[model samples]
Target: MRLKSALSKVFASFVVKGIEKWKFDAVAAQERTLKKLVNEASHTVFGVDHRFVEIKNYEDFKARVPVRDYEDLKPYIERVVAGEADILWKDKPEYLAKTSGTTSGVKYIPISKQSMPEHIKAARNALLTYIHETGNASFVDGKLIFLQGSPVLAKKNGINVGRLSGIVAHLVPAYLQKNRMPSYQTNCIEDWEQKVDAIVEETINEDMRLISGIPPWVQMYFDKLTEKSGGKQIKDIFKNFQLFVYGGVNFEPYRAKIEASIGKKIAAIETYPASEGFIAYQDSQTEKGLLLLADAGMFYEFIPSEEYYNEKPTRLSLAEVELDKNYALILNTNAGLWGYSIGDTIKFISLNPYKIVVTGRIKHFISAFGEHVIGEEVEHALLSVANEEGIEITEFTVAPQVNPTFGELPYHEWFVEFVKAPVDLSAFALKVDKALQLKNIYYFDLIEGNILRSLKITILQKDAFVNYMKSEGKLGGQNKVPRLSNDRKLAEGLERYIA
Candidate 1:
């Protein structure tokens, strides 16, 4: 009864918050958020430190800090390693989030103790939204399956130095553990079979209902779960499951497989939360509400889409930030970062632009022969073809390759682990080609003359990607496969299978 009452309260709060959010359109939210941001930035910059306190409107603090990438912070991390405060204001930051990013070697972004609640609150809001959507707050009653990173700590001299995931794991309410599932340590999932076996043993017989994790790892877990359940498919094994919540990357490619595995069309929500900040989420029916932690101690910046078209690109401040623009995102999180580019690009879908679709990564692109191709264009074209032909892409990647006969071809090769293969490759290829042409005229022109060849498709075993990620040691957590390769060597490694 206590659990039921608590869940009810959570649901009520979510419904209220969600409705309140809808009342204030995306642009209005930005209007409010930006004003707060400028005010906060003034104090934060002038103080030369980050902390949770309202700043008096100091004019000098309003100067915009230059945008920076992960590379810019290497020296600060070096300072932390040498036992100093580094970029953050606090003399002692509680811990740092160690998540892998593309083109950037392992990044150790400082995470603050003050910022921790903001993350937890966002996570809870996500859960509440899920419960409100599916009417399944009973998950708190059943085993709350979290396909998450483990809480394993490195013990130095008999004291625990928290792993990034561990700090978050420690925040899980003690009141909620009686119905929780096992957390397979991300560090330990290296022994895939054993970890899979343990999770299956713990969760299979129990009435496991809800799950949250990255799509790749969640897919792997379900794949393994299906394998051990007397050859029963995933859908059959977890038939009673009410929710399959996944985040950490784009879920569009793997959506069908997850639906097929679960047997029923469960509540499928796309979450855009990270260790850095809780930015957005998608729940039942309403256009993916990017529930912003407006009051969180973070000042956000947006770089207009037009900037990307320029040779020497610059970014847009919150003042200049407008609606319906694609921008490279920068965050001045409660975690010490001044106009830090987190590398993700998003298009504000509305004028009251709280809703943003993470279009692609800024650096995930290929350029050669005056043609620039990025993940958004590829995904748009692929999905356009999928919608036209009533087909779904399982997984895909693109690369620019040179041909002796032709100048260059941006090859869009993909492996589709479909339930049923397309009956007409020729027709599907033409559809995909047309979509590509529409998105980028340069790519289309190349295809017409074989400068860029026609689209290529490869059908692999359904679990091929799951197994491949496991084999490559990138199956779980924050890791996502790069959709575009910068050159031929890496592209060639993946090209032979293109049909």
Candidate 2:
């Protein structure tokens, strides 16, 4: 392992001063292209673009190409599988970003040749954020920070045999400084142990000011940092490491405790990215609230929560979204996932366009005995239960678990890491169960307990959830503790109690 002596640390601190600063800067062409993407997103369907040049205007485009869900594109994707790439757009796909789904094996999502630039742009934006927050830029010249995401691989047939991380890793800008760590591609993910080992060694002795990756992986990095340093805490170890960046899903459950363990309120950035594109980012000032990259190579639309389930959702174009409204995000990217619903639920936070907060996944819900619960409902119930119990829940995950006696019913197991464990589990369960009942009056009576007593709470010590992830081999990279379990197979995989 590379070791950073105290002098090396001081010298590295001097090096940090020369790194270049990144501002949220772009050229006029970038802005024009972004606007075009948004406009195209607002107007098209089934591989056609500039569909409403005949419509002659923006509002007419909105009236024609309503926001759509993934299922709506099933036909187009099927056509792609049949060797027709033009069903959605004109580009022949450079590659497909494979995303797993419960109903399907793996969706070979066609991301266009043009999508690579957005990845670099999002990265620069994230880097810019670090410079602004830390006041450190080429602003100094130490080892460049590396985002430890997944790696890429090439097959005998010349097709990439790895994830999106692998593909993007191959596309790293040659212009960046050499002080940076290995690209996700070169890290060689297929050899997991070796990949992790290399990252651990590099992180221990290097000057890494900004680290970007999935939250679980970053957490694992800190844990490994401690282990590599012969049990020194991360706070004592990564003294020069200023900010830890993350994206994908909610960091709410782990935020307070992770910060506590890091021994400082580490500046945290939550981003909204997908296989389709880096759709948005959380501002340095906003924290959890994300700002849509409205000017990126994508057109965006938001359909009201009520209309999300309808065959035709009422669409709000990028120029039309409002504050505090629950909307399902729809996208039209340069990659050609036109009118695509990423299936995330975000609430608009500001009206000038692009300011939003990702509230939760569209399907991240718990029914508590077939009540058809949603994320908002779960958050509400959790808060109600916490308030009633005079406690605060720091970590929790809700899923459907089966009990033979109760048959197949959705259960919200409150695995809480609290400030203090509450005395009354029954009352806490009752409080949550009651709020759920407000959503579905039939649930209480449907269950024998007359209050859906299946709901339960288990208090945990801080770091318990992180420890669980470590044991599960899901501690790092592009994995999350699956938030909703529609069926037992995947649900069983995330159920830590059984193991």
TM-scores of the candidates are 0.84, 0.76
lDDT of each: 0.63, 0.61
What's the residue-level lDDT of 468 in candidate 1?
Answer: 59
When superposed on Cα atoms, how far off is each prediction in RMSD?
Answer: 4.2, 6.8
The top-ranked prediction according to TM-score is 1
lDDT of 1 by residue, 108-176 (tens): 666666677877766666667666665556666667777666566554222234545556777776656
**Over the full model, what C-alpha lDDT does candidate 2 score relative to the true structure?**
0.61
Best by lDDT: 1
